[model samples]
Target chain A: MSSPLYELGEPVLRATGLSKLYARRSSDTRARLGEVAGRVLFGRPPKEIQSLRKHEFWALKDISCELHQGEALGIIGLNGSGKTTFLRILAGQILPDGGEVWINGSSAAMIDLQAGFQASASGQENIFLRAAALGFTRAQTEHRLNEIIEFSELGDAIAAPMSSYSSGMKMRLAFSVMAIVEPDVLFIDEVLAVGDFRFRQKCLARIREMRERSAFVFVSHGMGDIALFCDRVIVLHKGKIHFEGPPKEAIEIYESLDEPASAVDTPAQLTKAMGPTFTNSGALKDVAHFWCDESGAPVTNIAFSDNVHLSLEFTSTVDIKRLILGVPVWNLNAHYTTGLSTQLASEELSVRTGERLKFLLEIRGGIANPGTLKSMMTILDGAEFLYRNPNPDLVIENAGHPTWGVVTIPHQWNLIERQ
Target chain B: MTEKLLNTRKERAKGVRIYRPDSRIRQNGLQAVISISREIRNFRSHITTLFTSDFRKGYRGTVLGIFWNFVLPMVPISVYIMLVSLRIMPRYEGLSPAVYISFNVTIWFLLTGLIRQPIQVVKSKNTEMMKTAIPLSAAIVSSFAQLCFDTFVRIALVVVIILAMQAATKWTALFIVPIILSASIFCLGLGLLLSILNVIYRDIERVITILLQYGIFLSGVIFPLASLGPLVSLSAANPFNVFISSAREAAFAGSISQPGALAAWTVVGVILFLYSAWFFYLMEYRIRGSSE
Candidate 1:
C-alpha cells in the first residue's frame, strides 16, 4: 500500500477552483417560446432567445481537494450537490471551466456504472474495450482477462452480449474491468449501494484490495461508510464545500445539520398544535383529501431524494396568529441538516376553528448518501419546540399522526470475487 | 486534516515545451512523447476492438450482421440503376443503360458514406472519448478506422462491378484519394463545428440528418452530373461532389488527373482542415466543459 503511494508522489490528484455548471430545466424556456410563437402567428409579441432564459446552476463551485495516494476522500452532499460531477472532472470525462484538475498519475473515474462498456458486445468483449479505453493494451488485458471475468461473477453471461444482462450485472462487469487497470486514482460514486447486500460486501472487499495501490475518491450519503473507510470527508451545501475534516467530524457536522424532527409519528396530534396556515382542508383552503375507505399506504420509506406531502387536519376555534408550518428530517440517530418552513411573509395566518394545513416537500439527490431516515412535523406558537404527538386539543390543538416519508434512496449493489 | 495535501503546481515551461497542467511532471521531450505515443499505441489494440465492435453494432440485434454493411445499400442502388438505365437513359444520354447507371450510383454510395457518417463523429462518441486524456485526434481516427473498413468492403464491390464493365480504369483514376480527402476534410471541418454546437442543441443532429438526405440527391446519385450541366459541374466542384466524381472517374472511365481541380481542392481541403483543427484547439477547454 505504501509503495503505491510513494510512486504517485505527495498527492495523486489535486483540484483547484473547480466548478461545474448544468443548464437548468428547459421547460420554462419552452413555455415562453410557445407564447412567443403563438403571438407570432396571431400578431406580434416581444421575442427573445429561448435558450437565454434556460436556467444554469453550478453543481460544484470553487471545489478544491487534494487526494493523496492510497487515501480515501469521502464526499457527502445533498442531492444534486455535484459529488459525481467532481469525480467525472477528475477522471477527465469532463473539464472544469474555472480551474484545473492536475493529476500526477493515471486516473479512472466511475461516474456512470455503465460509461465505458460496449453495450451490444458480450461481457468478455466489453471487458477488453473498457480496459483499452482506460489505457491498457492487449497484452496486459489478455493476461488479466481471466482475473477480470472471474471477479465479475458473470458466469456464462460473459459470452453473451451485454444487452442481455441485467443492469446490476453490467455495472459489475464495468467496475471490475476498470479496477483491473490499477489506475493511480480511482473514483467510486455511490456504486456500493447498487446491488444486494451480499454482493455489496464482496465488491467492498475488492475495493479494499484495490486501495492497497490506488487513492480513491468516494461519494455516498451513508455516513457509516464514510466513518468506516474514509481518511477524510468533505461535506457540501448547494455546491460549496461547507465542511472538511476527519470522517467522524465531517459526518457529525453533516448529520447535525441534516436531521430534523419527524412530522408523522404524531400526525393526529398536529391538528391541535395549530401553528399557522391552517384552513378547513389545507392552508388557503386549497388541499383535498379522499380518505375514509380509500387509504393508500403512505409511502413511508423516506430518504433524501423524495418529495414529501405533509397533511394535517385541525379545528381552529379562535383566529390563529403567526403560525409556522414545517417538516424536519431527523436521522436514525437524530441529527439535523436544516429546518424548512412554510412561512410566506405575504400570506397572513387568519384561520378560525376547524381547518387543515397541507404542503409538499421536494427532495433532491446528493443530500444524504443512503440509509434509514426519519422526519417530524412541528406546529409551534411564538418561539417553541413542538414535536406533534397525536393528542387531541382544541383551538391551537388536536391529535397528530405521522403522515408519510415515502421517498427512498436506492441502495444499488455490485459484487466481485477474488481471482 | 493536514496542510500538506493542498499545495499548488507551478508554471515552468517556456514556449513549445510539453505542458503538464500539474507542473511537477517535468516538461521534457521524452516524457511527452512516451506518454502521447502510448496513447497512440493504445489505439492499435483498439482498432480490432473498434472495427469488430463497429462491424457488430452496425447490424446488431438484426439478422445478417456484417453482411448488411456490405449489401444493404446495394439493393436500392441496383434497383435505381435498373429503373434509370432501362427507362430514363434513352431520353438523356446515348450510353448503355445498365453500364451508365451502375457506374454512376456506385460512386454516389461511396461519397454518401463519407458525408453521412463523419458528421460530428466526435460528439456522438463524446461520452466515451472524453472519459480519458487520450489525444482528441484519437477519437476522429477511430471513427475513420470504422469508415475505412466499410469503405474497403464497398471498394471490393466497385472493382467487381467495374471489371464486369470491361472498362479498364487507368492509373489516372487515383483521384479517389483527393476526393476522399475533400469529403473527409470538409466533413471534419463541419464535424468539429457541429460537435461544439451539439453540446448546446442536440437538434443539430436532426438538422444534419436532413442535410445529408438533400445532399445525397443534390450530388448526382440517381442521375449523372452531365444532366445538371455547367451549374452541376460548378456544384460538382463542391468538395463532396469532387469526392464522388473522383471515385467515379477512377472506377468508371479512369481519366482523373484533373490537376487544376485537384490543386484547387487541395487548397480548400487544407484550409478547412487547419481552420477546423485550430478552432477545435482554441475551444478545447470550453467544449470539454460544455459536454457535461
Candidate 2:
C-alpha cells in the first residue's frame, strides 16, 4: 500500500473526489429554452434541467490521488477513459463539476506542445511569446533565452518564421522551453512520442533529471515508457480507478482488459467441464485442456535459456483426416513471434469420429524478451483451421534480458585496436 | 491524529509543501470583479507582448507599412469631400464641410474599429486562447491597443486637415482627450460583450456586420444630423452621434452643448464594462467547452 518514493516526500499536489459530467447535446427546443431560462434566472445551471434532456455521463468520477515531490505517477488507460480530462482538470484548464484539486507551487503543463506559438513569428519570437503565455516576464525569459536556443539546437533556423519549421523542430523548441522553466510541478501528456528516437531519449533523460527536483504526472499508453519512468501507477477505466499499484501489476491489469471472457466461446461451460486450467473453443475440434512442463515437472514460470514443454488435449466430434496441430507464440502486445507445426515436422496423423488427441510441443524461452508470452493451440486439417484454443491464456513468464523486441538472437561483439 | 501525522510528515520532508484544493463555486459580482482584476494584473506582461507583436505583424507585409493606418481612414474623408464639392450632398451651413465631415468620420472609425477588433481577434485566435492559460482579457486589451494606435493616426490627420483649411483654433480643443476616452470606454464595454457572445453564437458576427454597414449613414458621419429631416431626433439620440458631435464642437465651435448626456453615457459605459467582464468569467468554462 505504501511506496518507497511516496514516503520520501510530502504530497505536493492532491485531488479529492474530483468529478466532471457533460450533458448530451440537446435536440428538443423546449429543453434548450429551459436551460437558458435557468441560466438567466439563477445564474447557475439547474440540476433538474439535465433530466429534461436525453442524459448526461460523467467524464471523471470521484477520482482521488496524491503526487509527492521527487515522484512520478503514471496514468494508464484506454482512449476515452478520462485520462486527458483528469490532466486538464489538474492543470487548471478546466473546472471540475464536483470535488476539488490543490497544488503547492507554480506549475506548467505541456498538454498541447504548440498551444501558444504564433505561426507568423520567428522561433526566437515564439519562445518569448510562449514564455509570456506561461506567465514568465520579459526579463526572466531574456535571462534564459540563450540556454533555450542552445537546448533546442535550432541554430540559424531559430531566426526564421515558425510556419517554415518542421513539426519535429517545433516540438523540440516547445519541449526545450518548457523543460528549462523548471516549474515545481509538471504535467506531460504523450508528448514524448513525437520527434526522432534520439530526441525522445534526450527528452526522457531531461524529464528524469527534472523529477529529482520536481513532481511529474505523466500520461502515456506505452507500457515500456511507463515501466521505465513511473515510481507508481494508476489504471483508469470507465471514469474510475480500476487499479492502483506497482508498474508491473498495473500493466498486467491493463493488458487483461483487452482479453474479454467473451473472446473465448462459452468460457464458463468450458472451465466447468475441463477444470479452470483449460479453455474450450467449442468449434469443430475443441481444445478441452492444456498445461506446461519444465524438465518433465508441471510448471508455470521458467528461467532464461531453459526449455519449456507444452501439452494440449483436443477432441473432434466429426472425423478429421490428416490433422495438423500447431502452437503460435505471442508477446505481451499479442504480436506473433514464433510458431511450431506438426505438418512442418512431417508428423501429421489421421483421426476417426469422436477421437481425442494429445500433442506435446517444446519451446525455447531464451529467445523471448523478459515479459509475458502467450501461446495458442490450433488444430488444422491442411490449410483449413478445424479448431483453435478460444482463450490464448497459456502464459509463460520469461526471465530474460530487458531487450526492445519480442525475440533476441545470439550474437558476439569484439573490440578492434586502431593505429 | 491524522492531521498531526500529516504535519509531522511534512515537517520531516525538508522543502516539500502540502497542497489542498480550494472550493470553486458560484461567486457574487464583487467577487468576480476582484478575481478578474487580479487575473489581468497577473498577466499584464502577456497582454503587452500580445499587443506589440500584433501591431508589428499587422503592417509587416505592406509597402506603405504604418502609413496605411493613416491612409485607411482618409478614403472615406476624400469620398465625402468630393460628394459635397460636386453638389451631390448638402453641406452644413455654419460648420465647414471638410472639418465637420473629417472630425465625425475619424471618431466614427475609432468607435467602429474598437468594437469590431475584439470580435475579430477572439475568432481568429480561438485555438491559442483555448489551449493556453492566457487570460481572455489579454486578447481584448491587445486588440484595443492596436485600434487605439490607428485612432491616434486618424486624429493627427484631422488636425492637419483643419490647419490646411484655415479653421480658427480654439482654446477648448484640449477637451477632445476626455471626449475620446469616454467614447473608447463605451466601445470597449460593447466590444467585450460582443466578443464573448460571438464565441457562443456565430450569427452575432454577421448580424453586427450588417448593422455597421447601415450604422455609418445614420450616425451623421457623411453629413449633419440636422439635415436628416424626419429622422433628426433618432439621429441626434444615437450614442455615436453624441460622441461625434461633441468631438466636432470641441474642435471647431470650441465648446460642448450637452455635457450632461455625455457624462451619463460615460457612466453607463463604465457600468456596462464591469458587468460584461463578470459575465465573461462566469461563462469561461462553457465558452471553452462549446468552442472545442
Candidate 3:
C-alpha cells in the first residue's frame, strides 16, 4: 500500500492563497437603482451599498495544497464549506479573486457529469460534442467512439436523441466520454455517486487505475470512500482548511465535526462522565443520572447473552399526566434497532411539577450487535410531546458475536441425511 | 495529528509553493494579454465544438430546419415590400423596394442576432460552462461563430433577392465585403461587452431587447433614409444606418457612399473590439463569481 509519505515526489499541482469573496446581492430593485443613482450623482456609493460590502465573506481563504503524481487527495466538508469552490478554482473553471494555481499538466474535471450535453442531439452526436467541449479533437473522439459506446452500453439508443434517454443513461454516456480522456491531472466532485452500484464500482475501479497514472483531487462527503481511496485527506470548515492528514485521522476529525442531534450534550458529558455514554440529554425532562443495574453502578460495557437492567432518573418542570416512557436504540449507522415503550406494556406513570421519576428498563444483550448502540429517551403524554431526548445518557455496549447490522438473532443450522 | 502531518510534509516536499492572501503576484497588462491569448489558444477546439453544437441545435427541432434561417428574416422583408408596392410607404429612387428592404433587413438581422445572442449565451449556459473546464471566452467565440453562420444564410437570401429584381451588378459591389466585415467586428465587440454586463446586471439584457426593437425602425431597414425629413441628419449619423445603407448602396446602386464614415466606423469597430476584450479579461473573475 502506498502511504502518503511513501508517495512523495515533485508536486504536479500547487495552489496558494486561493480566496473568493462573495458580496451579498440586494434583491430590491429600488435599493440597486438608488445606489447607482447615488454613485452617478455624488461620485460615491450610498450607505446601503457600503453595508452590502460588509456582508461579503470569503468562500475560500488561504487554501493551499500540493498533489504529487500517483497520489489521490480527498477534500471533505459540509455544504457551503468551499470544497466545490476550491475544486473549481483548481480546475481553472473559475478564477480566484486572490492567489494563483499552478498546474504542470493538462487537467480534466468531472464536476458535473451532465454538463455540455445537448438534449436535441442524438446520443452519438452528444458524445462527440461533449468530447470536443473537453478539448478533444474530432479525430481523437472518432478513434474512441466505439469504446465510449460499448462502455455506456446504450447500444441502439446511441442513435436516439439525448432527451429520450433516462438520467442514468445520460450520466453513463457522460462518464464514458470523460473516462476516455486521459488528462495528467483529474478533479472529481461527487460524481462517484452516479449510476447503479455496479456502475459506481466500475467507475471507482477506473478512477483507481487513473490515479495510478495521474494526480487526483477528489471531493466527497462519504468518509468510507475517502478512507479507501485517499492517501491524504483535507477537512474544510467554513472556507478554511480545518485539518489535513492521513485519511483515518482526517475522517475522525470530520465525523466529530458533524452537528450532533439537538438533545445530545456531548461537551457536558465529556467533562462529567467517568466512562463512555453513547447518548445524552432529555429535551423535556432533564436526565440526572443513569445506571445499568440495581447496583446503581454505571454499565460501560456488557457481554453477549447477558441480561442487563437500564435505569434513568429525570425531573420534569411541568406536570405530565398519562405519561409514556420510550427508549429507542440505534446502531452505529444510525439505523433504528428496536423501541421499548411503557405504553406497550400498558403501564401508566404520572409526574407532577418538580417531581423526579425513575424508570427501569431491561434488555437481552445478545439481541444487539457488537458495536456502539445509542439510546434515545422520549416521554409523551397522550400523544402530546412532553419531553424527548434524541441522545440520552444511557448507552448499551453489547459485546456479542462479530456481526453487521442493528440487531442479532439466534438460529441453528441442521443437516439431514437423505438417501 | 494535522500539525504533525503538515510538518512532515513540509519538510519532505520540495518546490511546493504555499500561497497566502497577501502573497499574490499581480500581472501587468502585457502579461495579462499574453496569458489570455494563450488560454484562448489552448481551448480552440472547445470553442469550435460549442459553436457547431449551438448552430446545429438552434434549428434542430424545426420542420424547416436550416431553411428557417433564410425564411424568418424574409417575413418582415415581405411585409415591407407589400407596403411599398401598395404605395403605403415611399419607394427608394432607382431601387426595387423588395430588393432594398431585403438587403437592409438581412444585414440588420445579422447585426441584431450577433448583438442579442451573446447576452444570453453565457447566462443561459452558466451552470454547464462553469462546471466544465472550458473558458468563458470559448462560449463568447461560439456565439460569434453561430452569428457568422446566420449571417451567411441571410446573405444568401439577399443575393437571391438581388437576382430576382434583375438589378444591375457593378464591380463596386465588392465593397460590401469590407462593410460586412467591419460591421461584424463592431457587433462582436459590443456583444462581448454586453454579455459580461448582462451577467452583472441582468437588466441590461431586457434593455438591449427594447433598444433593438426601436433600433429596427431607426436603422433605415424597412424605410428609405430620405424619408426621415428633418431627422435625416440624426438617422444618417446612426452607426446602424451607416452599416445598412453602405451595404445597400454597394449591393443595389452598385456604388459606395459616405466612404469617410465607413472608414471611421471601421476604426471604431477595432477600438471597441480591443477595449471590450481587455475589459472582459480584467473583470472575468468578478463577472463569473457574481453569477454564482
Candidate 4:
C-alpha cells in the first residue's frame, strides 16, 4: 500500500532527535532568587512577595515524526494529549526549551483557529493580517484574494470588525484565507471543531485538496475522520506517540472502553392464538434475560444488524397456563426504541414444572447505531401481569442512522420535488 | 531507524517541494540561525495591525468610538504647557511664552509616551505571546514602534512651532537623531523589562500611570528644565531627561551643556535590554508549562 511515488535521491525533511521540552513554571520565589544569586556569587535576596503566580507545563515532549511529501500524517489523541501542541511545535509557533525541530517545507499552524486576528479589525483586514502571519507574502495574498473571499463567504461583513462575527463566521473567514492560500506544510488542530457538520465536511475536503500541494499534520479525536483522511495515523498519549500505523488498529487501541451492546428489536405483540387450556397453578417468574455473544459470554456493542442473537430464557417454576410475553427495546439513555410483545397463533402452551423456554432473537446485519440500547422482557399470566423485568443498557447498533428519538418508523418518501 | 528515516526523507526530497522553514536559508550561516528574519520583517505590519486593533478594542461597543487614543493625554499635554508658561516664563526672561510652551509640550509628549509604553507592553504579553510562536519581545517591539511613530508626530509639530518662532536652526539640531536613537533604545529596554514584570504582577499598569504623571512634571516636561535648577540636574538623571535634552539640543539650543548624556543613556538602555531579555527567556520557559 505504501508505494513510493518519487525517486530516492535526497532527503526532504528529517526530524533528527526531534525533541520538545516544555519547562513547567513553578511558584517558588525563594528558589528563583537563590538560583539567580548562585549564578552571580552573591547572597540570595529576600524572597520578594509578588501576588502573581504562573506555572509552566510541558504541552509537548520528545515528539518525533516524519512526513514525506504528499503524506498526510494524522495525529490522534484525546483532548490535551499534546497532539495540537506537537503540531504547533513543529509549526515553529513556540520554541522548545531543548532540542531541535527541523522541517523542509513552509509550515503554517492553526494551533488555535484565528490565533493572530484582531477582533476589532474587519474580516478583510484580518484576512491580510492572518495571511501574513501564515507566512504568505503580500503579493501572494493579493493573488489569492478572490479565492479567499469566496471561500470565506463573509459577504458584506468582510468590511466589518471580526468582533461582530459569530464564532462560525470567524472560523469561516480564517479557514478560507488559509486554505485558499496554501502553505507547504499545513498544520490543522481539530479545525473540524469550528464549523457545523456540513461546513466541517467542506473543510475536510479542502484540507484533502491542499494535501495534493502540501503536507498536513492533522490532529483529531475522531477515529472515523482519521481513518478516512490520513495516510498514517499516530495515537498520542501523554506527550508521546503510543501507536503509529493504520488508523483502524489505532482506533481499536485508542478506544479501549468496554462499551455495551444494543438490541435488535422489541418483541412487539403478545397474544395467544390457541384454545385456552390452563393450569392456574402454572406461573412464569422473571423474564429479564441477560444478553451474551455466541460464545455464551456477556457482550456489549451488539449490532442490530448482526447475526448476534438476544436470548430470553424464562423460568417456568409453576405449571404455567397461557403465558404471554412482551419485549421492549430501550437505549442506555432510557429512551425506548421499539417494543414487541409475544404472539401465539391458535395455540396456548401448557408448561410443566421447572420448564425453561429460551427464545433467541437474531439480527441479520448489525444495528444501525450500535451504541448502548437496553432490552426488557415481561411475562403476563393470561391477561394479568404475573411477572415483568426491565434490563437497561443493552446497546444494539443498527446498520442505519442513529435516530434522534426512541421509535423509528419505517417509511419511504415517494414524492418528487415540484418543478 | 536512521536508515528508515533517511529513506522516507529521501523520497520526499525527490518530490521537489519543501517547506520554507525546513530547508536551508541560502548562506552557510543561515541554516544555523533559524530565519528569525521573518519576525523582524513582519515588525511594521504587526504594529499597524496592533494599533488598529487596540484603537478598536479600546473603544468598541461603546457609543464613543471615543477617539480615546489621541484624546487620553493630548489635552493635559497642551493645557499643562500653557499653564506652566503663564506661571513661569514671564517671571524669568520675557522669552516668547509660546517657545517655552511648545518645547514643553513636545518633551512631555515624548516622555509621557515612553513612560506609558513599557507598562502597556505587558498587556500585549498576557494576550498574544503564548498562542503563537511569536517571541515575547515582539509584542513589546510593536508597541515601541508605535511610540516611535508618536515621537515622530510630536517632533514634526515641534519643528513647525520653531519655524513659526523665526528661530535660527542650530548645528545642535543634529543632536536630535542621537537623542531619538537613545530614547528608542531606552524606551524599548524599559518596555521589555516592565512587560516581564507585568506578566508576574497586575499592579504594574496602575503604578506606571502614576509614574508617567509624576515623571512628566519632574522631568521638566510641562516647565522649562532650567527653572528647576539642581532639581533639573536630578531630572537629567532620568533617562527620559536625556530624551528631552537631546530634542532641545537638536531643535532649540545652540549647544547642549551635557556632552556624555546620549552615550550614558544608550549604555543604560543596552543593559536593561540584555537583563530583560535574559529574565524573559527564563520565565518564558516557565510560563508555557502553566495553564493558559
DockQ, model 3, C-alpha based: 0.30
The candidate maximizing DockQ is 3
State TM-scores per candidate: 0.67, 0.77, 0.77, 0.71
Docking class of predicted structure 3: acceptable
**Cα lDDT of model 1 by residue, A1-419, tens digit:** 11122233377678888876555764543343334334332334223222334476677888888888778888987666678777777776655645677677666677676765676888888887777766677788999999998888888989999889888888788777766757777888887765567777888888888888888898987766666678888898778899988776677566545332352235334322333333232323323321111133245344333333444544444456666655554433334434557665477565554555553444454344344444445555435433333211101010121112222234567777767
Model 3, position A388: C-alpha lDDT score: 52
TM-score of 1: 0.67
* Candidate 3 residue-wise lDDT at B209: 91
What are the per-model DockQ values?
A: 0.21, 0.26, 0.30, 0.17
Worst 10 residues of 3 chain A by lDDT: A40-49
- What does the lDDT come to for candidate 1? 0.59
Writing each residue's lDDT as its tens digit, candidate 4 over B179-220 gives 766776567556555655554554776788888768766765
Please report, in order, the local distance difference test score of every candidate based on alpha carbons.
0.59, 0.72, 0.71, 0.59
Tens digits of per-residue lDDT, candidate 1, B125-145, equal 655565544445566556666
* Per-residue accuracy of model 2 over A393-413 as CA lDDT, tens digit each: 544453422345666777778
Q: Fraction of native contacts in model 4?
A: 0.14
Ranking by lDDT: 2, 3, 4, 1
Docking class of 2: acceptable
The digit string of per-residue lDDT tens for model 3 on A38-118 reads: 332232322222233555678888888888877889999877889998998888777665677877667789888898788
